[model samples]
Target chain A: MYGGGYIHDDQKKKPEMQAEDPVLLAEFEARIARGEKIEPRDWMPADYRRQLIRMIEQHAHSEIIGALPEGTWITRAPGFRRKLALMAKVQDEVGHAQLLYSAAETLGKSREDMINDLINGKSKYSNVFNYPAKTWADVAVIGFLIDAAAIVNQVANSKGSYGPYCRALERICYEESFHLKQGHSVFVYLATGTPTQRAMVQDALNRWWQPIMHFFGPSDKMSQHTETLMRWKVKMASNDDMRQQFLSMYVPKIWEIGLTLPDPNLKKNPETNQWEFTEPDWNEFYEVIKGNGPCNAERLAVRRASEERGAWVRAALKRADQHYVTPLA
Target chain B: MNIQSLDPRITRLGIDAEEKNPDQTLQREEHWETYQVFHQKKRGEKHSSVGVVHAPNAEMALLFAKEQYARRGETVNLWIVNTRDVLAMNYDDYDVFSTTPEKMYRDPAGYKVNDKIAAYKKAQLDV
Candidate 1:
């Protein structure tokens, strides 16, 4: 009824009419069952297209905004190698954003519209980046833990039903692995360094722990969108399942470095064969998604400023196209 | 050739002098509109045509191609060419040969090369 069509109106159709034009739902189900990738030109259910666009566009927005938090550290990196690595990593995020935006463009949304939506706060990016990067150790935590969480989600998306999105994720996942490794290397160095360095690492970890837990969203039972997404093969795993996978892979490594997670309830349960941890505060996540995060204003301002600054470049390119000519004696 | 009419920046670096007069320069720039992009997946390999990018100039063409085609790490080398320079045969002009029957002799699979090679090897062994 919200979009103008009644949900129960189809029940009034006669049985003879329904039997004549049997819905192609079975064909769509069979296509998913065969593990076939649905290309852009192929026919698909309207909801599947809507879901893919929402997920992919949000992903593109996240990559673009995610660069700002890390871009702040490029000038302050200690050594040449670290500086170069950070710069390259930030550039890669820009490149990844471009790739995803192009994929989303193929789904009927223009890049300009998507970008405008982001700047106007009509859409949302990953809530993790909305948290401030307080110290140098915060950078390492983001690269390691935040990027690690992203890798878990990306790995699942690499096998998604959409052909171009799947192909794009394959390359993105490879680059994310490098970012995770670099972050982990920095954390390991700090963890084994002086008392102050260890303390910095611990403090950063404490601030990030809650956001990392909330990264995967609420439990599967609570998510209304999860069932339809799963049935359409757009999402292969539930949010809670992916969160547990992240914990299983990361908890031991955190413990090995002799650092404590902020959550007091975090432990390995032998009976369930899973890591038991405190649930993240959903209210905070809700607030962040509603544009109430600490860095939301700053992030939007930076993006808008950059867009304004680059207007001259686009104008120059356009003008050169019309008036360009060869020189003569 | 009216060089003074164009933007001063275009003429500042003497890039315009490398070409012919104004008309020829304009013609060449117009001719250079189509660009073919080649991507080298690995070092020391021949570049292959991945796609084409269009622009008004060579520099912008290459930049556009890089953004449009080679953001991923699969490319090591890229070649951009003007589409005007490429010579292609027209299908409409080749009607005499277009409907010809399949030529099995041109295919190795149709000739049973494996059996023939096996027979040759057997002959050599006998010898």
Candidate 2:
């Protein structure tokens, strides 16, 4: 559910696409045009398969890593009910990772490789997690605003042409409804509470605003590559459009609570009906992706340590007759 | 340096901040094999294919299945099968069933004898 919708391919030099059988490529495009879901075993173009594996794999990794930030708040949640709800939310995030991993697995990468890539930081997740959730109110900002942004991305992706990814998103979007509601509950409680509580929530919003603005990545440069991806149904909505959608839907809700976003220039343009705001620093975003962000090292370190710690249990359960087979949808 | 965090649990884990896990790549089948999960939402409903989960054995597969598929829904039952055991038809062979729908001979609605009976009564009345 935390997939940011914008896929970051090292596009400094776009790889020349492999020449697929023209007839097969045509048929594949035709099927997509007909609104048919492309199943795992179907003949897809090489670029289509590659883009999908990357997109879905990155999405899956986001779900897993996305849990860590929220998981930080579980033990410290204010009440018993809040603790239980946070526990369930964290569990749901992990489960979402599993669903997404299987969806990517249908494209032929093994689960181990995906995990390896994630822990090694070869793959990128949603960049927002690189920041620390410093307080209880930070968790509220994340749960409400961050989850809301992810829902915008995920709901659009559920309509995508890949069958398994679409199916996974369908289930994920269902569960994310609860996450958004719980987040709103926490946010509202803080925003409408004592002056100290409102200040805490407002401070959290100030810190998260930039990261949330950077969530969908930089406005996508309209290139032939992006067009091809869109035509293939690999990339559904443009990053800018999805960002606009998120701002339109949630900005009002945030304003209604009398909470101000950190950006003074953030306002809907009554003339064009598009929300305009000062552009977030794209340089910082790229730097964070390069592993210089505040919490990136800790996040990967913890993940690697968990893998190391769990090795014994997995080794114990290793069966002599076990064999790996690609999952069928 | 040890990792520092707002969450005390992570801080207390005392992990070396710069620890490089050089040999942490999971071996093939290290996570075990996949099982295709079938979920029945309610009693008397047919079990439908939900998704796949990896586990060491059938029991573990079922456990993971419940966690993955039945977490939020009203799942009355679940079935897990080894992915290798499933013999599936290729998309290439989808044409095998393509002409089947066009036949219409297999459909109960295809047998429209009422039209012929009505035609016979009309002819009798004309005579």
Candidate 3:
């Protein structure tokens, strides 16, 4: 249910474009251009496979890690009904991670490798999860706004060129509609409740504003790398475009509920038809991404412990005759 | 330096905030092999391939599949097959079926006897 608009690529060294067989490369490009999906066994350029693996793997990690903050609230949800709904939402988030991991697996990275990379601090998830959900209102804001932002990203990605990823996203998006509705219900209730409740939601909104702004990552530098990824349908929309789409879709909803965003500068430019606001501190965003955020250590530690503690049960279930096989999509 | 989490449950775990564990890696098959899942929306409907789940056995795979695929949907039944069991043709070999559509003799739409019968009826009327 949680994803960001940006995916990170290692910047230390640009990938050396190996001279692929021109014939195969053209056919691959043509297939993409014709809007045909690239399947698991199809011939593709090495760069295309590498980029997709990275993007989908990061997305998978985001869904799993994103569950932790909201998961903290399940035991303390305001009522029995809210508790049930929150539990369902958390379970769906985990299920989404599994689906995404499987999608990335079709590109040849195993789920184990992806999990190891996550817990060992070798990969990144959605940066927004690094911040803590300080109150029940925080959960509402996340479910309502964060999920809204993610839907914008996921909807675009469902139309991407990879068959397995697209199929998984199609199903994921369908389930996400419920997440959005439930989230909005909670959000509206809190916003329109007693003065204390209203203030709590407003305070949560102020704290979460920056992270939401940073959710899509910084404005992308239109580079040659980005152009190629777009042509390949790997990068579906620019980060800024998604951020604008999020603001346009959700800001009025927030205002209509009498909640104010932290930014006084937030407005739509009449001429350009774009959202303008004080840019979120990109320095802080990068720092959090570098594993320095408030919840970064706690998230990884919990994840690591889960894997370690579950080892015995996994071992007990293992059959001596078992052999690993790549899944067919 | 224990993590003083706002969530009392996390705080109760008493995890060291500064503890840096060695690199954790899972061995191959640690999560076990994958099973492809087929889900039927309702009775009498054919089960269609949904996705895969990694588990230790078919029973666990099916359990995982229900949690993953049938979470919010109408489902009467589910089937789990080991990924190893299903044989599939490679996409590279897809061209083998490329010319099948052009074989008009095998197509029902290729038949034109109605037009010939109509022409014969018209000619008989003219005579």
Candidate 4:
């Protein structure tokens, strides 16, 4: 649920290297064509491994980073019920990170390297979390709207080719469904409770609207060529399509609840059956990815401090002479 | 990371985990391998993997998982399974696990007994 649609497409394709083994590549591709899931020991093209690693590493990074914005509110949650639920939700996010990191490890990258890359600003996460959560109502908006958006993405990705990640996501999506319910409950309380409470929720939604739209990334016309990735089931659904699907499903629900979207242009087109809306600013998205967002510095600083503080415990618990057992699918 | 892959002597380098010795043997790899956590909320129920935990050993993993996952629930039994010990086949072989559509023979719905039952009732009434 932590992932967004902004896929970083910077992996340089080595056509020559992959072309060296056409027969094996064809066999690998044939398996994929037959709706076969790829295992860690499966004979896949080098680029496939690289692309999967990059995507999964980014996803794992997003889960942990995404926790930061929500984790801050645990202590400030209004009541015991809200506090307990928020703490569990945040812990679930961190557990997802742990699961995702393991799934990525099946591709050969260690969790340490991924964290280092994230902390050193050499990697990316979801663009939405860079914005600050300015109010308690922001928590509601994140829990309901943001989580709803992630379900759309993760449910699609759960049918992906990688066995480990798909399994991890299957469990994750189950937990997220409960999260959505919890979030919806909180949102309904705010939206229907009091005049001030209603205003707070509306104001929070207004602020979060742009980031939510940007969550799905740029348009398909502006997208990178993903034909091969799609055929391989690496990229399950396109960003624009996911965005359209999210809007069609959630916009009416928002209105039915007596809340409104910030974008007036957000509506479904009858003829094309596409939801039409003003595109979010890709320039700001790219800028935020470059580490200039409102909370990026603070986020990384906190992560750095945590790693240092937890170093001793990790050291004290270290063991030697281990065996690498193949993980279950 | 699996510490078993390292030579046993590697532990002698120092307590400092960040030791950057020139010899590769002295290097330490941080991050524990993932262990899947399963909890049975009540006795006699099947255990299900609720989440994952990372720790140096299985005992520690169980403890960590108990604290992180079991606190909010009524857990009666907890199981910590190393992801490595779980053997997963390729998803291309997924048909082995599917029991839908063509597998109606395994369910009571597969039987069509309405007509037979009606004939049996009529025969009984006549007798």
Show model 4 residue runs off by greater than 4 Å. A11-17, A221-225, A322-329, B1-28, B34-52, B67-76, B81-127
Instruction: Put down candidate 2 lDDT per residue, A1-329, tens digits, no spaces.
Output: 79996687886655789999999999999999999999999999988999999999988888888888898888889999999999999899999999999999999999999999989888888899999998999889998989999999999999999999999999999999999999999999999999999999999999999999999989888888899988888889999999999999999999998999888899999999999999999999999998999889888999899888899999999999999899997
- Candidate 4 on A176-205: residue-level lDDT in tens? 887888888999999998999999999999
Least lDDT summed over 10 consecutive residues: which range in candidate 2 chain A? Answer: A5-14
Cand 2, B chain, TM: 0.90
Model 3 off-target regions past 4 Å? none
DockQ of 1: 0.04
Regarding lDDT, does 2 or 3 come out ahead? 2
Chain A TM-score from candidate 4: 0.95
| DockQ leaderboard ranking | 2, 3, 4, 1
lDDT (C-alpha, whole model) for all candidates: 0.69, 0.92, 0.91, 0.78
Give lDDT tens digits, candidate 2, residues B1-127.
9988777888899999877968779888889999999999989989999999999999999999999888875888999999999999999998789888888798998899998999999999999
Q: How does model 3 fare in lDDT?
A: 0.91
Compose the digit string of candidate 3's lDDT tens values, residues B1-127: 8888767778878877787777557877898999999999999899999999999999999999999899875999999999999899998998999999999999888887998999999999999
Off by over 4 Å in 2: B124-127
Residue-level lDDT tens digits of model 1 in B39-91: 78899899876544535567887897788667556777778876556665543
Candidates ranked by lDDT, best first?
2, 3, 4, 1
Candidate 2 CAPRI level = high
**Residue A71 accuracy (lDDT) in model 1:** 72
Q: Which regions of candidate 1 fall more than 4 Å away from where they truly are?
A: A1-25, A222-225, A319-329, B1-38, B43-58, B64-76, B79-127
